[model samples]
Target: MDMEKEMFDIIHTSEFSIFSLSQLPHDDNSLLLGYEGKVKSFDGRTGKIIDLWEMHEQRVNTIDVHPGNSNLVATCSADGFVRIWDLRCLGKEQPKSIKEVAHNRAVQSAYFSPTGNGLVSTSTEDTIRIWGGPHFENLSIVKHNNKAAGRLSSFSAIWGWNDSYIFIGNIQRAIDVISTENNITTPLKSEYMTNVPCRFATHPYKEGLLACAGGGKLFLWTKM
Candidate 1:
């Protein structure tokens, strides 16, 4: 990959009242910018504010687009809610609908399933909840870690090679290989980095090579 090439041509720049950025799927040319309790979609080419949607009555934390389909995206807020949007039907005579109350707490990550049929999100409650459907309905909940007071520090990321497996990450910087066929979650061999992993990505064309980064460091690994 040419790191020198511009990713998203920074179509717009605005002040946000939040902590992080909620980006749309890379394949698409749109970005969802969250600020002070609302969400807006910006054009990736011209940096024009194309569409806007209200997600919460309070501040929002993050937004994420679906991996397979760019039309669908997810958002989480400080008000402890996760919402999904279908951008395809926006601003029509009868536009698409948004799903609110998707989660119970301040969500950390709201991610779509690799197959685009379902989604998974993590909360401050220390539980990972999975939802189904392109419409996004509740499906299953995975509770493995203990909850702590005053915002427990946790990191949860998912990597989907296919519908069969999703690699999950934890605060200790270790990963769990989740088998979607049987819902079996197994921890992978630890990388032993200096800090916990904050991001995950796979090779564009190679199936076994994977990359992860955290704490100002990057690491690449290949499956044998």
Candidate 2:
């Protein structure tokens, strides 16, 4: 409750209103923020903005830094573009996009696989696209029911431990898993899951556990 209230206040503050945030890998003191159409890096301890990069025509919905390469970061936005940025190249007024794909519609989430060789993105409608290969081309399009969730932090497809399994919530009160290698869809249902999960987080050490949040509650799932 306290954290939610704090976030509510922060979102109302124009100077601190953030659409998305990301933590830079291997750098403990730096943090990344997607404010409006710009990306900024700040000193986490001092609340000082160090650098900024212009990004996205619309608000960035999600930002995911490549797990293997910290220099490679990805973002999806309402502007219908999913992009990868090389953080080594920065310009607040003219940020360079290393690579991008035109979704042609608002994208909700773009996440890199744990191996960082693959990427998975969720759209506002019916498609979940997976990108891979040397250039991260559009590899496959999987059908999914993602039209339900509406808020800023809504149904997002996420990766499990390795690069094989992807997790996303459905309206049926179950978690859906999409296999990247075999291209199979599976549903994970539990009687304890009463509400549809909208957001997910993973722990660094506990690779076997995943947590999901919705309805002001959190559910932790373990692989056993």
Candidate 3:
């Protein structure tokens, strides 16, 4: 199917290139979008800007909505910071709270745990940091040396089964699994793997299943 040719609707937006976008978990009518140093929420159906604010010193990297609370959102940035926003105060000019200097280099991505009680962020500095609570207090940090190339090919971390582990790719041809309980990291062994995986995703409904991509190739792993 050609989606562009069979489109149902399209709503033009402001003239800035969006770096990342996330829809509120429970709201089909709203969307959160990030661009250069700023974040905005818009009416998904009408393309109307509901709120706007500058929360980063550089380009915003990614935005993730809390799974349990649709009003809560997390955004990471090229300025090495992560911020928590409350959509209840959507018109405010600043984030409700922030973790200043959350990373030493550009933060590539941030995701809230499926339980919405933990937040994890990855950076170009070869580190992953975890925070606890809906308020996002810093909890632990895991450092690695995956010096893979290219920002477009950068790695992302995601919470895996039971929110007990975080899965990420390293410079080596293997995935690194970090325990959320004790901040320990171990490599995933498999018959097939993606070398220097740049991005990966966990199956939404299937436990221990993952898809990884890098170097023009993709690999799927089952049962961790």
Candidate 4:
């Protein structure tokens, strides 16, 4: 027996490989993409370029949308920086990044907090950074091992249900929770965990429920 497989080209305008992309809020057709060291917006439904601009000196690793503000987005890059951009300033301005920081040697990813009031970034330089306040000048850097997980998923400092706690994996085969308020590190270890939890996800509506995956293993955690 033979099984037929088919593939369709949904986008044709972009000649370069897209590293990361995010759909603009409130508009299903609008999309933002990071490719060839540039930030670009294209019509998702039509596959037409809406706009393009030079964004970073190196590859953009991730594009994250603000949880509260549709107009705000964040991008992390191997250029060692994380920048915050305003979607509202699209055609009116070039280089719409309102805030940016030289986080590390290579930032793996950046994410806005659940409230959109704070930002966090994970870097390959073995550090986790937190930025907040009006100017985003209030910064705290926590030293941690964030090296690439060989043959496994790398670690990302993910926010829990709220903006106060960040969940990440440690070399001790346990989960580490970093407090945003005081910049403290706490470990969550269990006898059942056999491997490191490199990637994380928290229930948006649940307070303590957490999940992490690494080495093709998943662990669900809850405060006892």
Winning model by lDDT: 4
lDDT of 2 by residue, 67-125 (tens): 88898899999888899988887666778798888885789899998899899999976
State each model's C-alpha RMSD to the native.
4.1, 3.8, 2.8, 4.3
What's the lDDT for residue 5 in model 4?
Answer: 50
Worst window of 10 by summed lDDT in candidate 1? 144-153
Candidate 2 residue pairs in clash (backbone atoms < 3 Å): none
Give one clash count per candidate, in the order shown.
Answer: 1, 0, 0, 0
Candidates, ranked, TM-score = 2, 3, 4, 1
TM-score of candidate 4 versus the correct structure, residues matched by position: 0.85
Local accuracy of candidate 3 as per-residue lDDT tens digits, 56-162: 87898899988877777788998988887776765565555534446778888999888988888898898888888646665788887646766537788988856
The residue pairs found clashing in candidate 4 are none
lDDT of each: 0.65, 0.82, 0.80, 0.83
Best by the TM-score measure: 2
For candidate 4, write residues 1-224 as lDDT tens digits: 12355556456455688888887778877888898578887886777786887778898888989987888889999899898888777553457588878864988889888888888999989999998887678889999988755676667898887888998898778998999989899998889898878888887677788888877788998866
Q: lDDT by residue for model 1 over 1-224, one digit each (tens)?
A: 23688464435666655444556655366667777777776776776877766656677666777777777777776677877777776663334447865456667667666677777676767667777765665477777452332343345546566656666555565566666566678876554565555567778688878786766677676899
Per-prediction TM-score: 0.75, 0.88, 0.86, 0.85
lDDT score for candidate 3 against the true structure: 0.80
Clashes of 4: 0
**Which runs in model 4 stand beyond 4 Å of their true positions?**
1-15, 91-96
